[model samples]
Target chain A: MDVFFQQLVNGLTVGSLYALIALGYTMVYGILKIINFAHGDILMIGTFIGLVLVMNFHLAFVPALLLAMFITALMGILVERLAYRPVRAADKLIALLSALGVSIFLVNFAQLVWGTETHPFPVNISGEPIILGEVHIGTLQIWALGVSLLLMVGLHFFVNHTKMGVAMRATSFNVDYARLMGINVDNIISITFAIGSALAAAAGILIGVYYDAVYPVMGYSAGLKAFTAAVLGGIGSIPGAMLGGLLLGVLENEGAAYLSSGYKDAIAFALLIIILLIKPTGLMGRREQQKV
Target chain B: MLELKNVMVNYGVIPALKSISFKVEEGEIVTLIGANGAGKSTILKAICGLIKLKGGAITYQGDTISGMGAHLIIRRGISQVPEGRGIFANLTVEENLGLGAYVRKDKAEINRNLKVVYDRFPRLFERRKQVGGTLSGGEQQMLAIGRALMAAPKLLLLDEPSMGLAPLVVKEIFKIIKEINQTGTTILLVEQNARMALSVANRGYVMETGQIISHGTARELRDNEDVKKAYLGH
Candidate 1:
């Protein structure tokens, strides 16, 4: 029973990271309807930036995390302007390919600068575990879960109550109508990319702190897992991404604990496939009605 | 006032509108009535800068706005309630209405407009917190018009505002359009429902196969033999 509880805690912590990254995927998809393939590599770049902030600048954990997020957000805006904007009117497939190209370029660029070495992020958080009855939880894990929950709440309010957030939602529903309403769709899209990338960066930083390791390829698995979460919840739904992340994390953790550790990734993929087959619009997504 | 002089538009290789010309005097409700393929919506799109004009000029308030982008055109005091009642499905009714005045920065004026919109459509006021997608077809059309009004536009362009609406609801919508016009916003209405459109408009244009076949006073168009046999179901 204790083992199960411990694994559940671990799953929740990892799930928070997945949820953060998945938010970026879901948000960009919501507004643009194009999958930003480079999103994963953006997470990877975030991790490296966090590493640089800590190792070279000798910054404390929280400050380093903020700097990393800021940098990643700016990088996201640059990517939108340079890569996404030019191909805005192109075919979806072309945009997809362009995102993939940007992803590959970022990965290689990180390799060149960081030298492909697996660098360790300094452990600033105390390694002590707090005992809660029979279950022991790492303090860092608790921090990760708390921050993730806070970020999600912040995002929810931001989208619901704010002026720019309303515009973003409007643009997503119909670009032509949004433009007619005098919403600067280009600026709104750029803001979406910025916010999404910043969330991914936060996830990358938390994951690095928990794992104590960062690499150029760190974004690959994390990205794939978050994408799975986004699909599981509902691609364009904000709350759906959070729910999907936690569910994927718990499912994979329990599967590894009881079934096979080596097949944990396989479990996530299987769940995705099954969900797609059963409900193509996802658990929370509604099927759009077409007008003739 | 708005004028489209020999305006041409094409969709890839096919021509959607061929050298169309018309004028809407300030403070008048002018309508363009036609069948489904008569390029009624295309004219609205061209006016709003959604599609590029191949040739000719669109002059609005003495400025040639033919090549301006949609956002810039809206800033110039024109708003469109497009076909299909294209309200933001995920946003709440209030948020959707708030976005209508996105280009405007005056908070007091915005709030004033909001109160006016709510007073005009008490249904929207009752469902201010509801998501736009869940609204009934009539409510959605009302919300679309209310949103356009939020922009404080000098000119309002409505495309098929009566589509997918019950006749009773259609009557209510036309009533609102007339009220909006009386309050001093010039209107360009495009509709397949010729009778309702002509009833509200001061002048009307008859379009067929992307060309304007006739234009006159709304009463004259309504009484014309060809219009009576084809559109009015006489």
Candidate 2:
């Protein structure tokens, strides 16, 4: 029982990180219908930015996190303007290829600047593990869970209750109709990229604190996992991404502990394939019907 | 009032509209009736600035709006209810209506419009919290028109509001269109349903293969033998 509880806690912590990153993927996909392959590398760039603020500038944790999020968001907006916007009205394949190209560029750029070595992030928060009954939990895990929950709540309100949120929803459904209704689609798309990138940055910061390491290649694995989570929950569904992330994390963790650690990544991919085979629209995605 | 003189539009190399000319006076319900592929919707698209005018001028309230973007055109008090009822499926009915007033800055006026829309379409009010996608086809059409009204446009352009609806629903929709026009909003209606179009329109134009074949008052067009044979059941 204790072992099960411990594994559950560990899985949930990792799941929260996946959920945060997956929200970015799912939200952008929801609005733009583009995969945004560069999103993963944006996470890598965000972590590096946060590392620089903490290690080089010796800034405190909160300020470093904020600066990292702001810079990464700006990077997201710049990439959209330079790489994504021009090809937006073009073929979908071209936009997909452009996103992939941007991903490669950011990853290589980070590698050249930061080197290949894995840098350990200095912990400003205490490393003491909290013990509850027979189960042990890390303090950083608690922080990760708390921050992720807060961000998700904030995002929910922003998407549902606000005026800009309504415009964003309108744009996602029908671009021409949104424009006809007086919503500036360009501005809405920019806001989407900004919010998505900011969430990715938050995930990067939390992951760095939890794992105590950062590297240029770190984004590849995390990105793949978050993408899987988004698909599992439903690509265009926000709550679906969160559910998928949690399910993927818990399943992978428990499978690794009970079966074999070498098969952890394989377990996630296998679940994804199985889910797609069973329910292609995803767990929460509704099948849309067209009128002739 | 709105006027389109020698306006043209193309999709890639294929010309959708070729130097089309028309006018809608203030407080008039004017309709363009045509068979499919006659460029009726394209004309509306040009007026709303969804498509670039290849040649000619569009004047709304005596100001040239030919080169404006769709958002700017709406801000200029012209709103479009697009074909097939382009409601934001994922949003609630209230949220969809809120989007129509995206450019309006007055909170009290927005509230007033919200109340007015609710009062006009009680069915929409009943489903106010429902997702736009979940609404029935008739309900979706009502929401689309109500959404445009939320923008308080001087001229409302409706594209095929009767399409894909049952005859009863179509009657209800046309009745609402007449009600909307009677409330002092100028309207430009495009329809393949020529009978209904002619019934509610103060004036009507017959379009065929991207050109206006004929134009006159609704009663004259309704009485014409060509219109009787081609559009209204003989």
Candidate 3:
């Protein structure tokens, strides 16, 4: 029972990071109707950026995190303008291929600059783990969950109450109709990329803190796991991404702890396959409904 | 209030509007009656800047609005209710109406306009909380019109408002359109239902194959043998 509780706590910490990253995938997918394949690579770049900020610039962890997210957001907008927008009117395959090209380019660019070395994440909360009965919770774990929950809540309010957020929702419904309503559709699309990219950066930094290291290629594995979570929750649904991430984290942690440490990733994949076969639209996803 | 001089629109070298010239005078309901693909809807799209003009110019209130972006054109006081009643199906009726007043800065005037829209279409007010897609077809049309009215447009471009409704519902919608015109907005109506279109229009133009082949007062066009046979179904 103690082992189970510890694993649950560990699972939730990892799950919070996944939820943050998965939001980027789901939001971009929601607006553009294409999986931004470069998203993971972009998160990888964000981790490196945060690391450089702390090491070279000697900035505090909190300010470095904000600066890193802001810079990553600008990078995201640039990527959209240079790579994605030109291929927008083309076939979906063309956009997908372009995204793949961007992912490859970003990975290579990181390798050239960061030199493929895994660096220790130097920042840590100045406290020992909090013990509750038999289970212990790391301060980092608590921070991860608290920040992720706060960001998600902030996102929900922005989407529901703000004028720009309403415009974004309207654009997601119908682009041409949104234009008729005087919405700058291009501007809305750019804002979606900016917000998604910023969230992914925060996730990147959080993951670096949790695992105690950052590397150029870390985005590949983390991004894949987060993408699977988004698909599991229903790719284009915002709340779906959060739910999917949490469930995947818990399941993977439990499977690894009880089943086999070597097959932790394998277990997540197996569950994904089973879920996909049972419900293609995902756990909370409905098929796109268009009324005539 | 609106004038087009030899306006030409092309979709990648295939001409959609061929140097079409027309004038919409202030305070009159003008109907452009044509079959599908005759470019009646295309004209509305062009006027609202949804589609770019390949040649000529569109002027509204003496300022040339040609080459402006679609979003910018709405600020010029022209709003279009597109074909197929382009309602944001996922949003509530109130949200839909709120979006129509998107660019306006005056809060008090926006609230007043909201009241006017709700008063004009009481059914919309009753269903304000419902998602637009769940509404019946007639209700959806009313929502679309109500939304456009929230913009407080000086010129309302209505594209096929009578499409796909029961004749009785179409009559109700047309009566509402006439009432809206009487309350002060100039209308440029495009319709395939020429019988209904002609009944409410002060002046009418008959279009064929992207060209205006005939134009006259509604009574003159209604009595003409060609228009009756081609459009009125007499």
On DockQ, the leading prediction is: 2
Per-residue CA lDDT of candidate 1, range A19-126, in tens?
Answer: 999999988998889888899899889888888888889998888888899999999999999999999898989899999899999999998998898888775775
Compute the lDDT of residue A165 as modeled in candidate 3. Answer: 85
| Interface DockQ of each model | 0.70, 0.74, 0.70
Q: Rank the candidates by lDDT, best first.
A: 1, 3, 2
Question: lDDT of all predictions, in order shown?
Answer: 0.90, 0.89, 0.90
lDDT at position B12, candidate 3:
79
Query: How badly does each model clash, as a count of residue pairs?
Result: 0, 0, 0
lDDT score, residue A205, model 2?
83
For candidate 3 chain B, the 10 contiguous residues with the lowest summed lDDT are B9-18
Please tell me how candidate 3 rates in CAPRI terms: medium
Q: Write the per-residue lDDT of candidate 1 for residues B67-104, one digit (tens) a residue.
A: 98889999999999998977887778999899889999
Task: Report each candidate's C-alpha RMSD, comma-separated, in the order given.
Answer: 1.6, 1.6, 2.0
Could you give candidate 2's per-residue lDDT for residues A104-154 as a string of tens digits?
899899889999888888858755778999988888988888888888898
**Candidate 2 docking class:** medium
